[model samples]
Target: MAVVGGGIGGLAAALALSRAGHDVRVFEQARAVSEVGAGIQLAPNATRVLRDLGVLAEIERVAVRPEVFEFRRWDDGRLLSSTPLGAAIEQTYGAPYLHVHRADLVRVLAGAFPAERVAVGRRCVGAVRRPDGAEVRFADGSGTAADVVVGADGIHSAVRASLFGARAARFTGYVAYRGLVPAQRVAGLGLGRRSTVDLGPGAHLVHYFVAAGRLLNVVCVLEESSWTREAWTDPGDPAELRAAFTGWHPTVRGVVEALDHPLKWALFDREPLPEWGAGAVTLVGDACHPMLPYAAQGAGQAVEDAAALAACLTGASAADVPAALARYAELRLPRTTRVQGMSRDNGTRFHLPDGPDQLARDEVMAAAFGLSPDIDWLYGHPVPASSSGGREGARRG
Candidate 1:
């Protein structure tokens, strides 16, 4: 098996397939493998998949486990609702939610694969499928053929372009400004070291500790008429960011003002691909479904894709590869599409106009948190060692 793009999803797919007793090689475009972002939230669904792949111990070592998730008003520190995440989360979801630096999670996933199997600086240009197998072509005019090919490249995936014709990604007309502030520095600003999320009319801010309480990851999102760039490292003016959240709250302004260097990304999403596989090739992660970040399931769904792909491939014959690929799509598409829709819905809810609708949203949130049911249907899903050739089942723990 050949896995392209050595990001979290690619590395994870390589690790999962290798553990399933398949010979796997991971090709990364960068000179080295690393995550260049602030923090990533690993809901129980994602963490459970990581644990099954055997990287949970290392991940937990560097991660900060928030006791609960709080949603508050942006004008004043008024707690709208809180969901217990430590014991209640574990008991209900079968795993604890973790907030950790993206780099740390990448390291844990990368370490699981053998160093020799990972090839760096191999930018995948496209893929060519043959009767026997698929050949992954690289930018340097080199290629490698394998029985199976998995594209875990990000939103702009070369493999996707190779299989399905290139289509423009839908820009959500929103820009997110992200930065990492030291925990002590945040404390100095009078905002205690708590997982705080301040929501305003058209903008919101979420802050949490990462790197074992050493640093705080802050993300501020706002609806915008236009964005200048799509890259994650695009320089953002602090004044523009402050002006977006102007008159929201002092703490929110303080966090944005304290950012020495903040990065901005114009959020883009795509409808789920009609299919993720063709012959011996398949897609995973953002390559298959580029989702809005509102649900924070972008990485989680990718992790799930890796697990399901491995499960379907295990013990399959060469002739069964197509069926396995079909099974992978059937199992993944419904849930991921639902998540994508939910993320967009959350965005609409978060940016609700100040009126009775906003008050009704608050009431709904409070009631949902108070009557929180077991989320095992979403979090405790287990990848079967083999596809049952039946419709996938959604069951709670």
Candidate 2:
């Protein structure tokens, strides 16, 4: 099997398939495989897969196990909902919820993946359909063939485009600015032990400690109708960011003011596809389902996709590859689409202005206080592995 664009999804997919006893190769666009300084959440739904792959132990060295997840009102910093996440949640879900620096997590995953099978500096331009097998063409005028192809490439996936033609992502009219602050610099923000978010009209801010609680990751998302920038390379002005969230809680302001430099990118979303894989070629991660950060499940869902894909491909015969890919899509599409839809709904509630709706939201939060079942389904779910590694094509190295 060959996987394209060795980002988080691709790496995880390769690792899953490799462990499932499949010979896997990964092609990454960059010359080196590394993740940026941002932080990512690993809910139980995702941690289960990483644990099975034997990658979470390394990540645990640098990950922060937050005590709780708190949602606060934007203006006054009043707690709307505070859900316990440490022991009780862990005991209930069979895995811990963690916050880890992206680089550390990537390093941990790369350590587990077979290094020789990973080729860097290979940008996949598109896909190829040949008589015998599936293939991918790289920008370097070379190509490789494999019995199966997985497009773990991200939102602008070349494989997806090659399969379905070019399609533009619709802007969500929102922009998110993310930055990291040294834990020492902001020692008094009073958010020391939890993943917290302040929600309000037209904007929201999330912050949590990462790197063993040595650094704080802050991300602020706000509505922006006039601005239309689309890529991660788009630079941000600190003044504009501060201005957008003006009059927010003082601590929230402090998190923003502490940004020596930050990355700001416009948010975009794709409607859930009726299908994500066809024949021997399949898609995973953001390539098939891209969701807003509202649910904090972008990485989690991608991990799930990789696991499910590997599971479906397990124990299939050479001629059964297409049916396996189709089964993979059938198993994943409904869940990912439901998540995509739920996340889309989250934008509305997270950005509720000071109105009756906000009041009702606050009331709902108050009722839950420290134990909101609102996310029980999300936190309680785990991706199960397929135990079918003994079929016709299972003898491959």
Candidate 3:
């Protein structure tokens, strides 16, 4: 198997496949496999898959287990809803809810695989499906063939373009300003202990502890006239960020004030694909189903895809590769489509202004404080038993 893209999703896919007794290699375009940015939430759905890959302990070492997710009003910092996580979520889902540096999680996943298995600066330019196997050509004019090819190269995937032709990603009319603040600089703000979101009209700010609670990861999203380029490393002006959320809660303001260098990116998502893969090649993560960040499951779903793909290919004959991939897609497509819909809907729900509908939303949130009713379906539900390791293909076929 050959996996493209060395980001979180790609690495996770590689880990799952290698652990399932497949000889897997990762082709990363960058000189080295890495992830930038501050924090990413590892909900139980993702953590459960991580545990199977044997990196839960290492992730836990650098991750902070937040006890709750505090949703509050942007203007006054009034609590709208408090959802208990940590032990409660773990007990229910059999995996812990954690916040870790995005880079840290990527490192742990990459480290799980042998160093020789990953190829750097090997950009995949095109692919050709041969009868014996599928082959991918790289920018260096070199090629590699595999029994299966996975396009986990993310939203702007080259393999996807070669396989499915060109498709534009919907430009979500929002820009996200993200940064990490040292815990010491933002001390006594009552922040860094729990994950918090300040929801307001047309804008919201989310903050949580990462790097073992020593750094606070902040992601502030807002609707603005200028749409940032769809790049994560786009630089952001703190002044503009401060002006946008000028009248927000003191806590939110404090976080903004502590920001040394903030970066921004235009948010983008794709409608679920009609087909994830065909023939001996398949897609995973953002390459297949890119969802908004509202649900915080984009990465989680990718991890899930990795597990499912590994499960289907385990102990399969060469003739069974295509069927195995199709089974992985069959089991994954419906769920990812549903999640994309939910995340899109939640994006609208999160930024509603103070009005009758907003009031009703507040009331409902207040009533359900300390418990996210949706967690049962989102976190506690079983994810196709990807851990069974390759038996699913035969059983389902």
Models 1 onward score TM values of 0.93, 0.96, 0.95
Strongest candidate by TM-score:
2
Q: What is the C-alpha lDDT of each candidate?
A: 0.82, 0.85, 0.85
Worst 10 residues of 3 by lDDT: 388-397
Q: Give a tens-digit lDDT track for model 3, residues 1-397.
A: 8899999999999888877777788999999999887788989989988998899999999999999888899888899898888788788789999999989999998888999989999999867788966988899888998878899898988888888898878788888898998899989797746888888999989999999988999999999665545454578999999998888888889998888799887888887888888788899999999978888898899999988888878767878888888899998999889889988988888899989988898898889875565666778656545444443433211
List where candidate 2 sits over 4 angstroms from the true fold: 370-374, 388-397
Cα-lDDT of candidate 2: 0.85
Residue 362 CA displacement from its true place in model 2, Å: 1.1
Enumerate residue pairs that collide in model 2.
none
Query: What lDDT is obtained when candidate 1 is compared to the true structure?
Result: 0.82
Residues 1-397, candidate 1: write the lDDT tens digits: 8999899899988887877777889999999999886898888889888888889889999998888788888777677888777677778767778888999999988888898999999999888788977889999999999888999988889998999888878778777889898776667665543567787888888888888778889888888887556454587788888888787777777888777678887888888787997999999999998888787788888889988998887667788888989999998998888888878987888888778999998887777773244344566666555332322321110
Clashing pairs for model 3 are: 311-390
Q: Please write out the lDDT profile of model 2 over residues 41-102, one tens digit for every residue.
A: 88888998898888888889999999999899988898888888888778988999999998
